[model samples]
Target: MKDSAVAPTRVDGYAELRDYAVIGDGRSVALIACDGAVDWLSWPDLDSPTLFAAVLDQARGGRFDLRPKVPYTAARRYLPGTNVLETTFTTASGTVRVTDALTLSDTASLTPGRELVRRIEGLAGSVPMGWSVQPRFTYGAHAPHLTRRAGVPVATYGAEAVAICAWHAGQPQCTTDSVTARFRTEVGTRALIALPYAYQEPLVLPTHAECEARLDHTAAAWRQWSDERTYTGPWREAVLRSALALKLLVFAPSGAVAAAATCSLPEELGGERNWDYRFSWIRDSAFTLDAFLKLGCAPEATSYLWWLMHASQLTHPRLHVLYRLSGGTRAPERTLPLSGYRGSSPVRVGNAAAGQLQLDTYGELLQTAWLYTTAGHRLDADVARRLAEIADFICTTWRQLDAGIWEVRSAPEHFTQSKMMCWITLDRALDLAVRQLIPARHADRWHEERQAVADFVETRCFSERMNSYVRSAGSDDVDASLLLGLLHGYRPSDDRRMSGTVSAVEKTLRQGPYVNRYLGPDGLSGSEGAFLACSFWLAEALARCGRTEEAVSLMDQLVALGNDVGLYGEEIDPASGAFLGNLPQGLTHLALISAACAIGEAAR
Candidate 1:
């Protein structure tokens, strides 16, 4: 942690949490500052209006910030399976610890009208403590009217009113309008800051005596969830943490998983590559399902596949690559004028790229459905018809130019990976039809299209000079996306072309454990930090190519990139190893879990 002089105002803004860590229930998440403030969170659910808006606009964004009244240093981590966060602050007077969590309701549905608890305990000598309760509403555009209800600070903005209060207090006032509490505490002195809805049914807030038992319950719950993981491998802890991260993104009600929690956190800080990742992307979740299934988290795979089936039945001309976490079809693109993260403008909300035709999605969809079928689930006739329809659509459209997986905007090309995915769709559809004895009207047509795509990829997509398959036909540039072709079983990993492609990726895209998605600008300006997941896929490909040692070494290097806790962002700067984009990124963690398990199996 770097030392900066504290002002009445927050010293650092947007990127401040980049140094902080994340804690969350599977339904909602919060960011905790190292100084012990619970800064950003979407209450009730991930999609709900935030109670702590300070994370987006620190000056105006409200936060539930808690810290030592005296200057201090701090560090924190999540308690294993649970989303509980324990951050310890060391002051010159003494060391104090604060544990934060939202107690999981025994009921299935969650209401915002529930309690969120923050427990602060004195660990050593006497230390003065401070708590600031600022509740801004509507993304920091409005201030809530504050009142005292049953001795708790309750702020009402609109229909939604938030209660913010200090559990233990002794010291004086800074302003009549603000809720600030400052006090000194001796060893073993404890406080509980409980924030519950003003209108909810009255419930007993946990007492200081009950805090320890509550913490124990949180830890036990997480352990039980983690014990269900069947991966008994060398990197079990890393794999389990990654699985937990993926699970954290799952929207509990519908089983749809968000691609990442945040929207418009840039891949390049000041670049235009920022896109809202809060929506569910079929392509992303397909790989997520594969990762979960590989680690024996079968329920996650099953739930998400059900969500995928519901999403695919929508009547869009081309299926959206991404949907709202609630399966909403319309994601209108818009931008915010607020000062972006590190002056990175315009902070975007809904993803416009959702409407673009990414042909690879069909392959991922078919493959994911095939996994469910292979795992002994029966497919309904309507779903089988829809699968055949997707295959037929790909057979007709695969020859046309479309946005490739990277969502390049200038002009679409005959991307090798996109074409290979078409091969996967056809191959999987035919395999399922034949193996499962389902009648297929388009089997011969799908097979014919599949062969043509393979022939084209073999002949035109390969670069003789590069000695590997290039990004697309008529281009010598290679892509990291093509590395997954072998992993998807489109071709034998030991094939001469597959081996050469792995070597080519190492030469062109490898930057430590980070990998670039592709070489050469595809009508976009500026460069990005190396993508973490593509690099892992490359490692998995290498392991399949008989390079097990190098694969394991790369996995180790990648795992080391996680911040003190087992979490990673979307990308890492090769020179500095700083996390970029969204925190606790789903794609990066899912790939890590999959690659580690795949390499572990190879070692045996």
Candidate 2:
């Protein structure tokens, strides 16, 4: 790393989305920029309002900063097989290493409700270090009440409190909105900082020794989890990293997997294309279950399927596009007044698409149930009956115009991919019925509707001139999501129609490894970068089509697209290589793992 100023450059006080690395303790996540600023963090739960919304509004939003006080260069990476981040800062005077982690609980010690640990070590000459913690609660809507608690600087708001603990750091100067400190480090010197948080409970003041032990134990725990994964594939490292990122998005209390770690981190910069992704989506159910099982995450798979069944029970036969991580059905869309990341205005909180009539979610949910049962997990009588009813519901639902997987805001249309997924939904349910996993009473009706869906897709959804499955009936636009239908067994990979659609996707939607989701209007202003997950789906489609070499080549390019720490955002600006959506996006990582697994299986 080349020498630079003490602080990393920012776009109007905001770090670029690509510059972030995340560390989480399975409940909540924090996005730490390369410059050692924790810019985004949601307390208590992944879907909760953020304590630090700096990524959305740098001013008024709060953050934690820890770095050398003088000019320096920094290089960072996750310690191998761990979510713990080790950032090495090299200054003219000396070198220092900082390890950042959201510590996990240990059986041997009394752990805090939540803890963020930062450990620093000096290896060369003296280097001055500075640190600060600015706490803003409720999406930066409230400035924290700063006070002292048992000699430690504490910030509290309502029922939540966070204690800042420091050792060998300068006296923390309490300000109206933050706590600031500075100190110098000598050779062989060790210093530590810990943030212990409590929600509706007493704050835990941890000793330095306890923090150190927790940090060490957290790293070990993550390493052990990584070691337990069974993905010894061609892109093992990327696959494992994707798995780790996905695991962080899984809510530990409930098995719901959040779509991304953050909310409203723009799909298009300075545009009205931002939507909150902190909720779990039925759209990703199939991929989530497939990825968890393929990576040997049996426990997560079981928990997630159970969560899915229980959460969807609220709507029963009619599934919503997304659900709250806590399994609540009400995600009332709202906006915050804060300036968005780089002036992407109207930073959003909840997703309005939950009420959309997406015909594809049924397919994804049924596909998930089918995957679970096929993987040897049993479904109870009620779940089986519910699955059969969902299949019966899809029998009629597939014929209606609805929002497709893209969840476009435009008028609903007969999206070909949605119809294909509808077919998968019934097809999977029918197979489960045959296997005696689900009630077979509606088997004949499901079969008839499945055939109707197939006929509709083949007749109206396919383009004769374009030689591909169109985005919607009577429209010539090609969608990258069509690849998903093929991967999910809408048809054999070698089927002429499926192969034609794959080639059409490459010719129309793909700009090398970067693939646009579609080239049509969505009733939204501004354009977004390439959808990263679609590209992974393309690679997997190729592998499943028996084009192993092409799949491997494409997979290599997509893997290389990730940032230095092997993390991906929701979208990428293909022209500038800038990450354009939420960082550490779970769907993108899920696609990566699924693609890697498919390519590896095809090669074998």
Candidate 3:
């Protein structure tokens, strides 16, 4: 086995997970360090046990660090139309190029044989490069034993086997870790490193030319798919980046889209609101469908709805707010013992709030269902029945308190958002029933309940004291979600009440330019950064309300909050406007695409 050129040098923890850029195969993803470490990756699939978990804990989280032996600043980008990641490190000595990608299986087979190909090419002066491979299984708890087979280093952990090898043009033996390799690259020198999952006898290694060809094909595939996007707008690049991010989150084989790639990144860093977002959410799906449709990305919408079709068939008493990526219904929550990112304690894996009764989901589901059916797709009878049953359930349960949109753990109250969603459920159901001329068994009843709910929002949700819609009845605090009331077709955007609510939200919940969901104390202890999705919602609502100029400015600012590659998290710090929370968030991208399309169309 070859060793890294230099001993492992810690990065002093300066690189936060937020600073990392993402690259992924359609099946799984890897988070690469700005300095060139493949820090976080899962094997076999997105939800599989981690082969590199260093992001959660630098010491125990197995990391595959490949970079110059000397200090260097790196620049990275994804090759057009592909998940291939290329990082160029500029050092005092010279420049070295590293490319990373997961190889596609050429034949029909399944095993722990996922290959992570990394190629290093010398572009300038001679530079030394290093490699470290540590396999931490089960979220950094178990360490694997390393051995050499046929002169190639392979790490074995339980049922998984990861092979690693390096080839450099005319370079002799360097140093070695159990799996690490070291070498030097000068001008005109090229080296290739491959990590292949081996299931058969003597895993055959692809030649350098074969690797290059595969990389080219992958790039072509991505560009071709991206070219299908017909969005021509002011924020075209940002929208494109967001669309790409959404594509990355999709677990292609299963047609399941995760809400976000990683879990528990924290809404407020070090706060208790940290929860897993790697699972698929019903609401996320509905919203994502509408967003994708707007961008002319119909395949994602069709695929997701099909996934929802199967998911809805589960025999549970009610649908979960979210589900596992592989369509698994069981997501029992457990805490990992290791310290979390930046000491954010209680690192959790499975989501516990999946069973919560979020009344708002009905509105989203029905609204998107209506969208698909209106677009000439036939409604599944089972889907329609289940949907109507949910509407009826909301009709009966709307008056009762449940967890609101934020999934707050406090004993449920009559959250105005929940009530408004109840209104939506009835509104869309009645609309669909009317369009199809089908008997809405309780059309009049649903209409009456919907109006009653609307009236409830007017009377109880709005506060006379602030002259704006409050978070809920008897509370003076404003909620940003009220902005959706107008956008969701509950009221005309020009309605005075909505205008007043928007102004009130601006005055109270708006931190500088960004918006917070609520001004009231969330039961959690720490303060949170401004919610980016809420700010984007404000932009969309403003556009719908005919405040196009203000909406455009706000949208520009929100787009600027994205990282260099055009990804955003849940929140942004008002001070520096830096992104926070689990990054490449589904909600954030969905909002960007929808806002861009709405603004783009309105402008035209």
Q: List the residue pairs that clash in candidate 2.
A: none
What is the number of backbone collisions in each predicted candidate, taken in the order shown? 2, 0, 11
After superposition, the stretches of candidate 2 with alpha carbons farther than 4 Å from their true spots are 1-7
Q: Give TM per candidate.
A: 0.92, 0.98, 0.92
Residue 564, model 1: lDDT of 62
- Best candidate (score: TM-score): 2
Q: What is the lDDT of residue 491 in candidate 1?
A: 90
lDDT of 2 by residue, 364-454 (tens): 9989988888888899999999999998888877789998899889899998989999999999999998999998987999898889889
Of 1 and 2, the candidate ahead on TM-score is 2
RMSD (Cα, Å) of model 1: 3.4
- In the range 1-604, model 3's lDDT, one tens digit per residue, is 0112322234445255546677777787778766788888877677666777776677777788788888887777777545577778888899898888776554433423467778888999999888777777778888776677776666766667777766772222323324665788999788887777643344555556666566555667778878998788878878887888888889888788888777666666566666778888877765688877777877888888878767766833366788788887888888887666666667788887887888777677777787777766767676777667766777777787778788777677778877887798898889878876334787888888998898888998887668787777767778887776766777777778878887887888776568988866656678778888888888887788777898899998788777644668888888866566776688988888888877776676
Model 1: lDDT equals 0.75
For model 1, the stretches where C-alpha displacement exceeds 4 angstroms are: 1-11, 14-18, 107-114, 169-178, 197-216
Model 3: residues with Cα > 4 Å off, grouped in runs: 1-14, 105-113, 169-178, 198-207, 315-317, 437-439
| Residue 120 local lDDT, model 1 | 81
